[model samples]
Target: MCHIMHIFLNIKFFTLVDFCNAISYEHVKLLSILKLHNVKFFQFFTRFYQYHQGGGFVCVTTARVCSLLQYLFIVLFSTFLVECVDYPVLFNNKNTTADGIPITGKRHIQLMTLIFVLGIDDDNLGNLTWCEVLALLCQKLPDLHVIITKDKLNELDICQRILRFKNYFVALVNKDMLPPVVNIPFLGPQPYLSSGLKLNLDFLFFWGSFSPWEGPYTLKDEYKDPQNIGKLSNSFVCINTQCHKFFIYTINSCIPSVIHFFLLCGAYKKRSNTKLRHFNELDHQLQIRLSRSYDFATRYMNLFTSPLIEIIAKSLKFVTGSIFAVLFALAAWDEDVLTVNLEHALTLMTATFLIVIVCSSMITSDDCVYMPERLMRSIIACIHYAPISWEGKAHTRAVRKEFDSLYPLTFRYILEELFSPLITPFILFFWVRPRMQKFVEFFIRFTVSIEGLGDVCSFAQMDIAKHGDEKCIFILAIDGVAFDKDEDYIANDGKTEISLLNFAAMNPLWEPPPLAAEFINDLKTHVSCLSVFLILFEHILKNVW
Candidate 1:
């Protein structure tokens, strides 16, 4: 029936003809991609569901489970193959590198650059205004400054506002030959100058507005949530050394964001949209930088973070070589290798299954993020890409309903499987540990230290970041230093003279986990109960059943 349904859908799709009956080619492509991914997901989840449903005991013939798993790998590999074929078009090789344009120095980077907008239709508020952004940069960049490098600059209020800054310098670029994009082929965009900030900048940041291009739309910024990754590229930055780091990671994360942005924005005519243009670009750029810190958030910080980390960590197990090994070893013959592997299977399976669970949690997001890159990559393949969004409203509704329908059964099944191993630990940790800790302050206090400190720092940073320093300090005054450290802690050495770290550590906010020695009493009770139940069940199933 499932096979027949699949065939029927395929036939109907190809047969459709007429205006209303027709779907957008993009939408059609999305369905095709979704269909493939959905199949992979279904096969994986079905086996996973069944594995946990039957009391979490595999007890199935090893050969049978092994076969399903092999088939599962093939389906998943096909998805990867589809992606490998599709990701190149939307993104070019290498991330944006801070390469040569001859404006870098060691302690001082003196750049005289222009943000030439390629074009903006006169009707749109955001078509090409750099007023708020220029004002904000001139104000915030400490000792650094910018000058009006072009005569055209004097013509706009945004540029005039910038000229008023304490350290502003001015120059006028020739309007006729303005480089519209940040990077041009023959001669790069106007170079920027950062005297003392060259060494410390996350990356010497700047952009070229699409003022001159007169192309399709305004090009504001081409990045989102970019991160400084690996080694610095060419970032030498001595007056003559002239090093510049390309920041590949940042550029990669931005591609999808930029493409999506262009798609949403590109479709509109300049005259149709009128919106206030304010201090948006700079704030957005800073936000992107901050989110890169998500790479460091611990599991305790966010439950979701652990799952993503686990997915990235386990990517090796699903490698082509690994898949080949499984295929190569499939004879199931009675050789020393088979026996040895079988003996080790239990341990490996436990680890593999746990990893798989973590990866599965990110499947939805992973699917969303890569779908466009994949589809865009396959531009010539004619395979339509899925809508690249975390929230596809219509799709979300369907997923929610589907998830809800499966939730009760899945949750119950998972709970049953999970409860077996966890029940003893839960009782020990929650019930037993508390009783022992009731008498021991030192042990109890030590167990949750990071969380305590994390709560303080995270909450404080979040507040300070949202409101200004004054607002943060004002709010801080009321929270009142609970401990002496609060008074002395330094937030960041680079940001300000004030220290928040002293306050961070001295607060005695976080406590470390307890050693097992302390929890033995509670553990004994749970372990005993669990052991007895297992033994009894074992005999009942083995002998009675």
Candidate 2:
């Protein structure tokens, strides 16, 4: 019996030592993790105390507390770094100015011209004659004046003159006298073609004016009058000329104004996708750390049997203690009274049973009433990326569905139950109000940019296309019929076929509906205006009544 008792004592002592060692190790591990993440011990302690006061640590073991602290330290540290750091903006090196402004296609052309002119060698300039110099200057500048007091131009060295010109150019740029950068309109062929082909095609379209339909044609006797032919040809030419002029005017006058309006409205706010992505990534990391902490805390606490059993044991003790106190009171009362009423005794017992059951139900166990960590995480994520209007409610639902689909049905149900109460109020306060303000701001800007030219040009283009196609077909038919020599005029038939094909290729400008490029540009402007206006109108109505 003594030998058995000594062995039992040794085992108990060893078990106690192991438990103490484990607690010490966990404390050290937690401190190390906090330090690794650059979290100060003082801040950690402050937060831990606050968390404890918040009832987060109620009924939780010391090891669980350590795990919770470590998780919080990582999340808080990451959030601090993200909020404090101002990461440098990165710009593409290619086609970008020294100050990191992107050089648009139009600005690029002007820069290239300036470079080419300045790159001329001194020897090459010296060999060029006066006429060549004047021609080169004409190409460089639209307005040129050469005032010379000297009788002979031979006194001026072309190289020195060019160098002087370059110095003047530098001085102007230094003084900020240069024109503001502009994106040149892509007025040539569509960009689908290869660069070399596009360049050649653009050159031909720019310099060549030979129309396939403007070839030699013998009119019928009734239509043979030279004056009548001249009048007929002049009308067609006038119509085409007017159409080209209108197109040019719209692009040159209207597009720039619209662009300027949008700019002024601050519609072109510079937002970095990379920064948003970084924020999202930080949020994800925080979520993972929280999950890990919960797992660690739960595992450590569960090392001792089930928490539910412990809760039940605690509840039974409370009920038994209450019963004993009641019995003692009743015995004392019975000593004071001759006898207790049977009905009163029965009522007292029944009331005590009901009270015990209710109190036990209210005594939530640590396992049963844990923090809604997953639900909290989902809410935080939604708050971060939620759309700011009822217009985007469908989108929010779609996003929720996608995310929810990743989880099992049991988890999904819990998340939905928690999320439902928060969704409406959170979206209204956090998302909608600020977005409405932005909508009003951008709406004013869009209205200013359009300057009442909204869709007028688009409508005109459509009308032109509708009428132009009919006119083209009529003109082609007249040419084919007038030039027909006989029923067997195979040669004339071939020419007419070729002409029709060529016309078809060139007729894209006057095709129904508009070019895809023009349509997209117009659509963007229309949608911007319409969306902003509708949102503002909705906001006003909502506030008024």
Candidate 3:
């Protein structure tokens, strides 16, 4: 009967006639892309219900759980593939020298010059051929260190090779081998920066926010004594090369002497270079202490410094006082209401427990911030400043629901999830099921089939002609690419181009299509010439100005 029902539904929904029944091709396409269908629709609602309650340890049937775990394992294994796991093997090449070859200073300088002239940035390091990379790595420049051994390099796939190069680049930076204006790129977008969230670091120190350190402190005389050596275990002693040899103070110390030392060292200022230098110079004990202190200060200092902190404290006190007052009122009643109606006492207790849960959730939901004000402020900020790129009532509602669903699996979260089943069905029917047509249309419109790959999203296919933007034409032209504007479509932000390059870079042996090969050549040529042009431009500007 189940098999019959499935076959009937497949015939009804998956037929060409059923697809043509939609209002228009465009409408159908939009709907298919946006809405869920078949098994995916069921999965969406299942996840919706799970998240709606508060995400927990997701449990599934034995049959389905294996499939779910299989996907999860794939994700984890993909990350592992990027890591350096292979043993190093020596490369035997007459064209490329072995690692750690003794070379003259002139040859070393030549190698450095070659690298600098190449203008290869970390992001595009993968674009180079394996031979080119291997040649550079094999040279074993005295300054630029390589962590992956020759054996590992010989066996590594493209992804691992790129990762190894990035690691090498980082090592160069750490050793101050790279010249000025060269810096490591932050791989992904930063939440605080992108979201426009302000962390008032200046106000923290500038507003006379200092409090007298209540922690243990030792005088210079006491620290000098051999008798008081054991007492120094609880203390942090930092040496100031500019001033005294060492000063003993605990974490959170704001004593005048410590403050004076901080000012002289310029440690109070938000300078990464200065801080890094000072941090490195510190003794092991002081280094550990400073690290802990900095972390603690950055995370929780706002809680203490904010004027609104007092309000939260007072509000909690007021709620506790009110609860006690209610209990007192019941105790002082002339009539024995509690005895007459014992259920009332039980109801009151239950209500209080719920209130406590709600308050605890507010406190602990966001990384144990324990600040209701902060949570409220964050929500308000999000509402006001969230990107409206996907503007629409439906989109907004969906986004808001998604944001609200994110919570740690605490007692309150568990309770919410437990009760979610009661309302999930109603929500699915009224809110989700009505939009089934949209999901169907969306999938129908955006999905494409490639030989051997079966079905995939059109976007994943990277069809430059369909989705490409014309605005990128000049940018491509600037890179020395000679292409017919009428024939070739320049991908928006060169995403398709970059994606292809990345794929080719990762799979060194994989031969690209003729068009793809031409595109890659153009891109590489552009990159090489662009770097030289930039250098010349910089030089000209410097001389002219």
Candidate 4:
């Protein structure tokens, strides 16, 4: 018995020593890993601060290179950033002129023109000859002009006075045709595609609508003849001198003002897709689908799995804790129950902070409550896992950074929600209200009144006849009637057509209209051809390799 006990004791001692060594090594390894991460975190933030402050060049360049990626970051990061810093402080940190006028799109375009079009260096942007100014106007200016008869000399005088300030006038006219140059990428020291760009500008000047603003902003009065209020523009030139007043300039420039107002009212749709149930409020087919989706999600889908629900649950807990804390404070302070004292007040304040901020933070941090165990292995994975592609090193890092920024996984999200009520009103009043006119114009111009459907978004109707691309080779003649391919109907980017096809495929029982059937066939043919071309190209490249 003594011999067996001695052997067991020796084995236990060795095992304990080994365990201690393993623990020590793991502890050191963990500290080193954490230290590395801390350094990387500090460097990342320092670089981000420097990058954002380096003028508008970075933002503009990023937007041009990958607009979708830029938008994703803006949506994901801007919200979190908004909580920490004011929007003006975040976006307007760039260097500005001594006059404090932030760089506008108009100014950017002129700068680009000076560099790319005129081949003028940055230092010599202001230096211009009378001939050079005229040349710029003749080449880049929009075709729009105001005709004044001899009797309307006052108008001519006004025009002359406007032209006196040639620099500003040039900027204004350039705005009419070309989009802001900030949208265009920088093309180094040498002017790239200067000839083609100049030719395109010249074409726009001669053929495009000559208006101060685009089609969406055109007024109803602009379309009507000054002499005869009812007479609008029509096809073909008027031979009669009297009919000259009704010359058609551009259809877009002649849209009624009321349409613009309507567009503004309906521009911002709520995030919820299935909120509208009535057919009148939505499309007939859309209404049915929305109803079915809502019903199915409610019945079969786990509501707790929704991120929105998780947020709401956290908010409710915070609210409840806050209410209880307040109630407890009121009850304890009541003269009848206990005498109010400084010590008691201080204790109450501390308890309130603990209940509201600290406890709420703890509750919010527990993100696993809503996420399914099957979907994610643990809370660590749920928090750190970012679905990002590894194509470009820089791009991948940016997307990962943005994804991390989106889910701070702290009390910040809850705090943001708490403060949103105070901030949202100011945003609506100052930002959205000021631009109400533009929004209204967009809605009115894009919407059309159908016979049975009443008023619907023109884009949603999928009317190839009205909005179909003329250059789309897939469009074929059905029966005796030929579909006109001359009109530019590139609205919705074929999303509506794709959605229709998807719906048809999902619901095999559903029958499409004759026109829609024809459109689907053409689209399918186009897609098949594209697929074949891609496959063949891939095969050829593989064989070559």
Candidate 5:
């Protein structure tokens, strides 16, 4: 390096002399002066070039070389140290920026892009959950630019967090291999492909066909080594465009340690199949450590396993405590869900006999009550075990269900369940087969109403059924068809009417009277038992309402 500097310095000296036409002896004297005082050599050379302008061939040859040296220095320094080019703004995420382009399709580039997180079903995840990592990522990155975020990171908070980004992109992987496989049966070709990521970025880096369910982020398996099975790309974070050099990495091959730090903490998903579950339960100790840094892959393999150890411990406690609680409670609890010790065995026997006598007398006393003995048995059993009941510690099944309820219910899971069959059976069936919901809803309401009476939905259904297979009375167009018109029939018994405009097709959007035929047949077949439902319902409503 010093020699290179010297050559350039000498070139400067000769160029001044020759450009000014200095003498050869003058050049020799200047060279000597440069040798004596290296500190002032440049100044001396300049002054000598100005004062002695008759060096002939000596000054001219050296002057040209000096000029060449100056250009060479400019080129080398710019390539190595300074910005090779300037780009004031970053543009690549298409959703946020018009300049955004699909980048992950480029294999070499994808390999060069670091895998921030690999959401496998359940292998290396040590102690933490991907959900918590996602929360942290949002807290840190705060932008919709990455795939796993809740909203666009461009919001003020996210904008501030984004300033911390040393890179242009962050990939968030959603591990679909988690437990409790809940696949929608109806969505055949068009499953509700979960969009794994949500982001607001100028450029998006994606590799696979990226189903709407897959990501705002990219994936690892989506871009394998082509020849190998699970080979990964270690040289990620280098696939940046030349323009990103100005804004992201100050040098090639320099991925900010922040990404790997996140990878270490975020890789602990319970299972990759966590389609709609929140997985953020890290152990107390590791969580404290993780909160300290956003870039921590420097710790090596320990980084991957530290959380795993804690998870194993917590999980052991979870499983054993849960299993034990269920077994103990079930063994201890009696039919009334009352705890019973050996001393209370006689008391339990007496209570059972008295209850049986009372129930038997009630059953035999009334013909209506006796008629629905099986249903009465069901009601009695329900009294023995209830959904919301928590009074007794002896109900093992209840204890088992509440095992993990010690933690606050995850809002994400709640939301997912809301869209599922947890509450509205009709909602689930509606997506695949609407006809099924009509009958199912009618059955529930019918069984529940008992007295052959029900609220609006049930009444609406009964009215529709009574008008069996009838065309909608509301379709009163000029081309309207009247009810009971055999000319425009829809259902099996041929009682319902169809519209003239519709020709022969029935209006599927609006069901034929609620539960047109199947519901009627099922209800009639079970009416002897169903009448008891009415009696029970009337019994309850009369006393309660």
Candidate 6:
């Protein structure tokens, strides 16, 4: 028996090492100790049982049984294979130096030379990469400030510089060209520059407008439009236009009113169609108010029909079912080998049946619990955003009814129709673990953090600042409709000390106004919605699977 145990341990250890080499060293060590103790205990128990048996036939039978058990253990251990799981690669070799040295003075000189050469070509100025732009800003621009700004500098120069170079800088960064070389120790290849560079630039270049001036504008003909100037592109350049004095003005402030123009255009164009005409002239303000009201109602509905609770309940049901399955297998095997009183056996079978019934009921109930809430939310979203009309309303109603009818049977249908045959294989091959969950959560959060329009805007602004101040000169490039009849002259408050360029007009649906209270509230709502969505997705993945 001891020899058999030693052979089994050797086979188990070798198999485990081959199959699960990626598992931590500590875990492998612990498994070895556990296997040794378990083998010793089994050997001792078998020997004691055989000695207590007085008959030679019984002793022989016990020895055969022990041998059979050892063979079974060897087969089971051989079949238990775990795939190696690799750790995620977070850093790359390209961004770090082998010797862990900082950027040397000689390398800095090389970068500066590259920037100067790139800046000499008017046509290629916008084509400079992110490394060239940073070098230009850090090394050359400070000394050439007078040349770029023409000695008419003031506090407004900062604003103008940002406006001019924002587009070019954004282009470079977008291509992942910034921080030309990373020489950090232990933590590289190169990661992106700090988020502050993008954020501060976005705030600086928030407002800009077109102005007619006389001088050489370096930008391409296609980029002359004001709308195209601030967008992400490598071809943006500042024009050296002549104006009487430095001033900024808001050319078109009430841009959100264009929504009315679109609505009216649709209404007039489709007036002959009764269904389309009904939605064409709907009040925008009324829709917004109703949407807000619906948002409030859905908050409470979500609380009552929380998807997380439903998912947890379903997970619990799965766990209970698995336990019952194992117990049933064990009970059947025991009944074949061991004698038991009829009354005790009956009681055990009855308890197992009751547990199975309860688990099935719980799973069924949990499966459909959140379906009503989802249907309601979907309907609300459709109505809130869609054009208001009888046709649209009818479509939404049809969707709602369809969802209601399918909710109760959906999970069962999916399981039986899609997963019935795969269930055993899935249980054998797949497992849920905390580390995998953490990796998924980290990835989601990283994605959500970078989704904002402001971040892109910021990167664009910084790109512009890196080129030079000459790119800040005013140019006439009007694209949008004029705000009023008085668009000919610059609307200034005659305050030269303060620039009007600092003010940005509010667009209700696009960029929110910078009013403190409204901005804060909107930010809070956006963050809350993002957090809820992440939680819901995580729960669904965990419980549904």
Candidate with top TM-score is 4
Whole-model Cα lDDT of every candidate shown, in order: 0.27, 0.31, 0.33, 0.33, 0.28, 0.29
lDDT of 3 by residue, 1-545 (tens): 12211111221112222222232444444544555232232232223222212212122223245665665665556565556223232222334334444545542211111122124433455465444643453343212211212222221222222222222222222223221221225623211100000011111111112211111111133323345543332221111111121111111222322323323333322212111121111122223323433433333322322336445644674685477557657757734655564446645755765665544433322353644333333332222112232223212334433333221123333333333333333333343234433323333344443332223334344344443333443444433434435422232223344345444554455566655676566656766675689799999999999
What residue runs in model 3 are displaced by over 4 Å at the alpha carbon? 1-420, 470-474, 478-545
> Model 5: what TM-score?
0.15
lDDT of 1 by residue, 231-287 (tens): 111121221112222232234223323332433333211211001111111223223
Point out the worst 10-residue segment of candidate 2 by lDDT.
451-460
Error of 1 at 493 (Å): 26
lDDT (Cα, 0-100) at 492 in candidate 5: 22
Q: Residue 129 lDDT in model 6?
A: 39
Query: Which residue pairs show backbone clashes in model 2?
Result: none
- Per-candidate TM equals 0.16, 0.13, 0.26, 0.27, 0.15, 0.17
Model 5 segments more than 4 A misplaced = 1-208, 212-394, 397-509, 512-545
- The C-alpha stretches of model 6 lying farther than 4 A from their native spots are 1-145, 154-156, 163-217, 222-545
lDDT of 5 by residue, 1-545 (tens): 12111111211333332222222334434544444232232233233322133232344445666766765665566574456322333332333323435536432311111112222112233343433333443343322122221333212122112111111111011211111123446722212211111111122122223211122221233232243322212211222222332232222112212222223223332212211111121123223323332121111111122345445545554554454455446556654333433445445445544544433322212222212223322322211111233323322434323322221123333333233323222222233122322222222222212111111111112233233343333321112223444421122221122111111111112223233333333333444454678799999999998
Give residue 59's lDDT in candidate 3 (0 to 100): 23
Model 4 — which ten-residue stretch has the worst lDDT?
4-13
